[model samples]
Target: MEQAELPSPPSPARLPWDFHPALTEERLRLCGRMLANARRDALAMARYEMGDDPWSVGCRAFAFGRNRLQRAASSGDYPWLEVLDDSAHFVFVIGGNGNGVPVRFYRGAADEPTERTLRRQEMEVQQLSLALGETEAEGLAFRLAVET
Candidate 1:
């Protein structure tokens, strides 16, 4: 008799951490629409991270858990999406509002952001995203995280 092999586990998301908000079809579609409208396609990256507290349950609780990390058992299940820009200067975050994660833009400073500063900022943002539970997104955007 031949022995059968067991199935291997799934692969987690290629992101820094596992976030619950899911990056689902609906959310992705809405986010794509928002970006297209805002003319913010000059983006570099997007990240979906786990969050602690969620302001509104809404449609957010239902993320399709695309990646393996996302599919794993999570302590909390709130999704936060964040997007970074081409220059690596501005960070546009979108985590809430119905099924659509609205975009909010932020500029680091007048001077160019250093790698250390960017890493620090990214860590800070990740922490916040974990607590808040509804957002972060990316690209030429997530180079800070991807490259370094």
Candidate 2:
């Protein structure tokens, strides 16, 4: 008798709502630990060191995005910036091969918003930025659609 294959479990994006970059090395170490603990079948995982050459990071982001169900990922001059997607935001860490490679993470996405999407994740971007060490003063002020 042939057995049926199990469907993949729902992979909800897991945002690091409480991250804070301590010592730069410490931050990467923590990211590596997180990556080690992330779901084995994560949709994307890429390195994102601050100040890396944009082209290099973009290449890695492209590789990661290519594996996503939505095929979306990119970076500006800032490799350690953020990712954009349609519905939600998430972050994941990967690295720790002991070669001293700095860890990278899969920050969640933020795309054009809809009423429902805004209601759900309007403030998530801010929170994720904070978690990633954006100071209160550095956080961007987002005006609601009605306010703009």
Candidate 3:
């Protein structure tokens, strides 16, 4: 008797959403919107800085957890969602000093975040806070021991 040949595994889908290119386009639009908003704020700040006017430099931070459910809809890296959901939380800490005191701000996600993702987000927050020169300390923080 001749041995039968087994079928090969199916190829992974290229798009994360059912809508194919539409999802990619949507995400790109979101990125563009964010950039445009940033640019507008930057221009306003530049105008304020030109006249030697005192500007409020403060950090605003926000963090949210992403679960497998959310990950299933994301078009980005799969490993990020997997690791973040499985084993590590992402914490963003932003520190800056303006008038005299050192200010610290923070944001955190309950779900696990990959080291690379966490680092990238952390750096972004840090740079933003530093640029502002004032930090608003708020949000989640990791505690080794809970004090009653």
Candidate 4:
């Protein structure tokens, strides 16, 4: 199905964000749907440690924008979106893997990661910054950290 494209959102940099430790199943289902039909939405997710710590955490964030039915065939950015459960603290969206749509959210403060799992991610962010210049980089939707 061809899902509608969501409207634009605020610059991720301007918003105050924090690390989201975990996402619950109930919340995921509720918010995942919310994102699909939202007027404005941009979200990010990541996996890494918090500066010299053993705690590996998953992160998700929702910017001010909108999302509809995004699928691999329909949208390269967010494929197989099942549900978006949005809440005060976090917004949960599910993306299908071979097993199911794994729910993740983008929340608070995250240092540019040094973890090797996302080694390329940091490099890409740098390249984007260099290519677009700092101000322009902030405008691009893809500038937000995207995790799968």
Candidate 5:
């Protein structure tokens, strides 16, 4: 009789974003739409600062685990999405909303945002919260204990 080999375990990095329990398609779609709104709003802000159309300006948004330093297993199943401006001056986190329909927001990004940048990001978050039919405080907290 021939011996059979066991299948190797899945790579940590190969895991899909939807592997997170709360990362539903609906939520991801909502996040993307909200990020687009944020980007469009930022274009106006950028125009206000630079006095131009900012037609070429853009931003990037993506999903990531709660704790970037830790393995996915240790990071829990909640998903966090980030939207960062092209200038790298502004960024914000759309935290897990749990059973709620509104998305949450938090400070910080790949590049450290300055006080002025953070204040601008806060204004966007406040607007987003109101648009989502929830108060900023209601969607303010992170879902998992893991720090981002």
Candidate 6:
């Protein structure tokens, strides 16, 4: 009997926010630890805030985003940065591994005002940046940080 062929891997999903160039090896390690330590606490906080209503769906979304970012940073395959706007919504700039493509990440709500969402968005961005070693203040922003 012939052996079966293995399935191909899925393509990486693109984020909806922009990225800067603050990603560094040292920062990635630091952020990884921080995210690893705080993930459970963060989830708990989300559950508390959203309760068991449909709004709780947002918490799951946040977790999905957070987990993706954490895994990408930990793998060192991609470099990224996170920024916080005045309202506190996060804007993430994710780059391709070795390639120079870029993608963004953020949350959206049609009914809510932007200001009300800033805090959570900003917190998410801050944690992601810390994990990737990138910061808005550094001004090392990049649409893509392709590894040569």
On lDDT, the candidate that comes out on top is: 6
Candidate numbers, best TM-score first, in rank order: 6, 1, 5, 3, 4, 2
Whole-model lDDT, model 2: 0.34
Error of 3 at 4 (Å): 56
Instruction: Report the lDDT tens digits of candidate 4 across residue range 73-98.
Output: 24555443343333322222333442
TM-score of every candidate: 0.27, 0.20, 0.21, 0.21, 0.27, 0.31
Residue-level lDDT tens digits of model 6 in 41-141? 44555655445543564455545545655555556554443322222132343333332212233344323424433333434444445535554423222
Better of 1 and 6 by TM-score: 6
lDDT of residue 85 for candidate 4:
33
Once model 3 is optimally superposed onto the true structure by TM-score, how far is the C-alpha of residue 94 displaced, in angstroms? Answer: 24
List residue ranges in candidate 3 displaced over 4 A: 1-23, 48-148
Candidate 2 local Cα displacement, residue 106, angstroms: 2.5
Best by TM-score: 6
Model 5 lDDT per residue over 1-148, tens place:
9989999997765211332334456555554444445554555455445544433343221122212312222345534444322223333333444222222333346245444433444544453454343543443322211112
Off by over 4 Å in 4: 1-79, 97-101, 107-148
Alpha-carbon deviation at 22 in model 2, angstroms: 3.6
Steric clash pairs (candidate 2)? 19-131, 35-93, 84-110, 85-109, 85-110, 90-108
lDDT of 1 by residue, 18-67 (tens): 43244345654554444333322222122235332332221122121112
What lDDT tens digits, residue by residue, belong to model 2 across residues 55-107?
A: 55444443443334122123223234333333323322211121111112242
Instruction: Count clashing pairs, candidate 5.
Output: 0
lDDT for each candidate structure: 0.33, 0.34, 0.29, 0.34, 0.37, 0.40
Per-prediction backbone clash count: 27, 6, 3, 25, 0, 16
Model 5: runs farther than 4 Å from truth? 1-18, 48-148
- Residue 48 C-alpha lDDT in model 2: 42
